[model samples]
Target: MDTEMYIEKDIYVECLNDIGMLEIENDEFFMSPYIRGQRVIHKVLPMHIMQTIFYYTLTLGEFNCNEESVLKTWDSRNEDRFSLEMVCKRWCSIIKASCRSLVLSLNNLEANTFRITHFTYLKKLEIINNVNNDSDYSDYDTSDDEDTKDYSNNDLYYDYFDQRKNITYRRRKRVPNKNSDKLARCLSTTIQLSLPNLSTLNLSMSNLKERHIETIKSALASNKNIKKINLDGCPIGDQGVVFLSEILESNNTIRQLDLQSCGSINGLEYLGRAISNNNTLEKLIWSYNQSNYTSVICLSNGLRNNHSQIKSLILRACDIEGWGALSLSDTLAINKSLRELDLGSNQLGDAGAIALASKINSHPSLSILDLSSNLISTEGIDKILLSIQSNKTLTNLNLSRNQLDLSIPLENLTSSLELNKNLISLNLSECDLQNFHFKQISIALQSNKKLKKLNLSKNNFTIIEPFITIIQSNKNLKSIYISKHKFKSNELFILLNHIFKLNDSIKLDNGEVVNIDIPSIVHQLEYIDLSQSHDPLTKNIILLLREFRKVNNITKIKI
Candidate 1:
């Protein structure tokens, strides 16, 4: 024991000498009684110990001592808390006090006795468990009276396993040992009894039942400081949504609520009402999973009242039609807080497109609008472009996969409305435009200098002459997509030569620019997409790709 003690003392002295602690000139101050006492008792005194002691002593009398100490202690405690616990008992005490956030990822957690562990000062707790794992105990049958249960209950239990076998289980069970009512009870008890200072709660990958919602409501009733709640991909029905709506109506601190991919339109209606009344919410994301047109219309009508303060609205695959678009237009025209709106993969037609375009022309705050994968035609696009010409706030617009005819006159379409200066990104892919359409687009590109990305892929554009001119003139244009369109070898080479000269990136379908000077243009090219192109160009393309690999200045090359 004496020999071991001597060895430890020698190691400690050597370490202190290495840190220049032993060669101090202010020995009287450095080796004071307070420092000596700490060194004698503490086994692992971290580097920040002196700073911690100094801050505590200097700020002893100030009222801000509590805040200062909280910050200082948190920083100091985090440094030695994890590794220092292995050193000795005194370190464990300090670490336990500082380590307030408990994160238990159930997949990695060891299986042990299920007893409630006490966390005194824990403020944030995250428990992420797999729905398929044994942790999912929601389906467990624990009723004492077995005779009272019918055969239907047994059939339901078997159906759960059968559904799992078929991979058709819609709602994932989070806790299989406890039923909805019991799980709710457990959560309520855990929140009120175990975690008192819990401010942020995120419960994902779970089949949230009605009783579980009640439990969450009961838990949130006392947690007034809870500022953010995320229930992503949870199967909470209308009743559960009502429970959350009540909570949101009373709670003012919750600034963001994400109930994405939750329940049906009924639940969404409840959420929209909650948002309508709640003024504190800054962002509400409720992207739908199924494309239900009726539900989308109902939700759009629910948001018609101008009291909603939502800034970002994402309704992907919501089966929104002309009527739904009109309803949303009415809400968005007057709503001042909304800035980003995504209505992708809906069945919006010319009327819907016109309705939305009307809102875009008037709304001062809207900056980003995505209407991709809709049934918009040339008339719809013409209306939108007219709106774009007049609107100053809209900067980004996507209109991909909307079968627009190339025969429409571009100048006449946008002649009346003033060109938008704020427009930056525009997509017009799969518009079925011929070579003549590119000339009109070229003229439009000359007028609009703010455009950065222009996509004209899957069109019947045969000539590349006008596109070459547009690329040369537009300095702000960074990306151009012109795939699935025929181009002559000489025309392709000319286009590539111009793009290389201008240092502009271009994406083209598979084709070989025969007898072209490759070495001269290789340095200027940044990105090229030639995935679908066939024949002899494939070999030359591969060789070019290899040559550019050695250059350091080239940022990206996509093939």
Candidate 2:
């Protein structure tokens, strides 16, 4: 069985010597007494089912599993957890005691931050003390600066054929001395002597203050099982949100709080009464804080009449208006545990979209409502599609870039998107849509069987035949975005080889025994973004998205 699924256990080399997972000083950690007593063992593949099939094939996934992090499979990754830490010292202490997360970096932490504080099966600790706004240090700082290399430049490797070029890497700015005080003394001695099964602490845009959040909320509020804390765009002020609202009112085990783009989100009325006497906060993103309208009615009067256990409230582009829409529609009719409300790109005109379309169908566990871009026309798009036409737990509705003059009440917003039917993802992107508003939303999605993801991306759109005849008359349209148009590089190079020969004549004239969920001849197009067009149609749309993504694997072509 692949030679005992590459056996290399010795009680994970005593959990990598009780924790200091060989943090250097190597001769490959003295390859453990030459395979110490290995008698070609494999008594019918036991060892905890081959160590749970070797950690399910070295997965770097499942951190809220939204896979396809821009698909860089690199030949299905799992280099057997880096060739079992280079095939030595009992497979390098069984791949360093299956370590769990450690994204540290105050740039070469004064010689391996005390052996990265002996990983002792760490849980999740991302300290990144700033590196030109680190996104995991701009995705693993890809080398090659050799003091501005010039190796007689082979014209910088032909600049990737110059047409849709993407070769960037110029990082050379390390000046962070005179006190991050050696990263707050190695984060006050690695949060007071190594991660005791730490739960998750991102510390984003890391230059976090208030004595590193009072020495990280007094060592994560005495291990109160810190659940999540991002501190995004961190330069946290208002006394770091009043010492993180007094550690979220004496930690009831924090749930998730991002505080994105925090240009000092000064006392959002002490983070809305410390999130109304918090009870395990369940997401409070507070996006791009550039607040107006009395700083969103002093943060929507601490999210009006709140009875904690908060449930998702994004607040994108926080420029909310006119009494930030009567204090966010009276805090959405007395916040009964909100269930996702984005408030996208907030310009929120038309009296803040008619004060949240007159109390948005009294939030029945509001299932995702984004009000995108917010130019909200057609007199607040007919009171936000007549309050999402009897919204029964809205399933994603983002009236995108609301320049929405949806052609002056395009049949009452296509009869409220063909009578809502509990929306299933809709985003009318840059909504000034035409061709008679795409044939009145393709005749209200012909007896609309719940919208299956649609976004009519930026409308410089020159009628791509009524969006491919409304995606060939939507039989539950899977996904669409009609990219940013302005074509003409020889008519988008003959409409990119006639849409890859019409997706190889509908996957070889629907042969291969049909049934791939035949929603109208095996419904294709699971996703398509075609980024920003005309760079000479980027090498024929990257050779028709690498030969139509090898004839199907949920067709996702985003140039």
Candidate 3:
């Protein structure tokens, strides 16, 4: 028999042997027939009958079904379909044509073993090179060969010293594996040839260097199907950004580009120039660049001049200070196409907050804003709140980790919370809010019916009445996070009873009458997190909440 037919017969025999229906003795095969749950076959089957069984067994189920249904079934199992593809040539063709998205690990790619060209229908491809672990060294063993040993100080070698055996074994130092780079080169050669339907390409953490960029730059020039490219955590730096900026300047089909932590701070000026010239790019995430304010000014200038369709911009941890924020606010003043802006984790003090607040009211398309950990005090926050009074498009606002103190009367802050009808979610966690601040927020929540989510965790406050009143009145509120609060048992019992309405009244250990009939009209609160409250009475409250959750069909409660 030929090699193909012999391999096919061996696979079928192995499958039958797995279920104990066939056994091999010497060079012949024996069949075991099940008669009344007992194996009784004592003779060998004919070669023609065995061939007939092998052909029928492999062609069963979806294997022989319609091509469309097979494609749909295999599309959901793309990662595991490689094993099934190796069964036969026909099976391989069916599977490879059906795969839509594939995640290939660079560590497993062998030379000329796997081909990206096989997946003809692929639309999204993610190639990743993960950090090396002990599994990568499973095949490596200690060897005393002098030719393979290197004495470089930076290299690591193992020396196994046995006391009882009185023997020392020296392991050969492991050289860094370059298979991923080789596979990346192999992919770069043929990536542009077959991937016509490819749209999203993620090469994050793939250790891409200058050589890989040269090949990728050539491939991306002609590949018009790609729209989103993620190069996060790849040490491509300035040279790689030059190639991408060239692509962005000419390519109009690409929409979103993620260069987070790619060490491309110096090349951001090239990106800013590209942003000025390009018109189709919508979202750009270039976060985690330290002290890149000069490059940010160039980017802001590009945005201020160009009428591009860019929407979401994230500059978290880019060390944007007051001047950078002021420059960005100037861009936001004219560029109405931007919607979501995240400027968290920088030293944007009161000056920066006041600058951005000046543009919030008149800006048309800006909606979501995150100003967390920016050192904004009451003066800046007061201006932001006053701006919200006239702002109609702003829906979500985050001002967490700021020095927020509302001890003195701030009428505009409370007035904005009550008057603003479009704002849906508010985050004021870890803002050093006291009793007076909580009371003011509670007073605002009484009138703000549009607000649905509130996060007030990690604040120093002992009052629970304001929170209970807010929960009782705000029927539109769906979720609340008030973790890290120290609550007494009686206070927690009253809160839980208000939600579940499990009790009318409870007598505390101090003989105080705690009424649970506070009449909470809001039963739509879907989630509540009261975790990290190390009170002794929390255990009973959790048990009661658990029983109430099962009955009321509540979504979640973290206690």
Give each model's whole-structure lDDT.
0.61, 0.63, 0.73
lDDT per residue for candidate 3 within 1-559, as digits (tens), equals: 3223222435555655777775445533343222211121223444445434333433443336654333333332355354343333344555556667667666443432246677788778777665464122334455557777674543466676889999886655566566555656766665656678888888885767655676677667667788998888777777888888888887888889988787766766778888898898898988886646788788887787565788988878878899989988888898989889999998889999999999998889888999999989888878888998889899999999988656544557578899998998889898887777788888898888888898999988776888878877778889989899877777877777776766778666567887675555455689988888757654567578777867887647787
- Model 2 sits at a Cα RMSD from the real structure of 25.2
Could you tell me which 10 consecutive residues in candidate 1 have the lowest summed lDDT? 107-116
lDDT of 3 at 498: 78
Best by lDDT: 3
Off by over 4 Å in 1: 1-103, 106-126, 131-200, 289-306, 405-418, 457-463, 482-494, 502-531, 534-555
Total clashes in model 2, counting residue pairs 3 or more apart in sequence or in different chains: 1
The Cα RMSD of model 3 versus the native structure comes to 8.8
Residue 290, candidate 3: alpha-carbon lDDT: 60
* Winner on lDDT (1 vs 2): 2
lDDT of 3 at 493: 74
| Tens-digit lDDT track of model 1 for 176-196 | 355334444555555555444
**TM-score top scorer:** 3
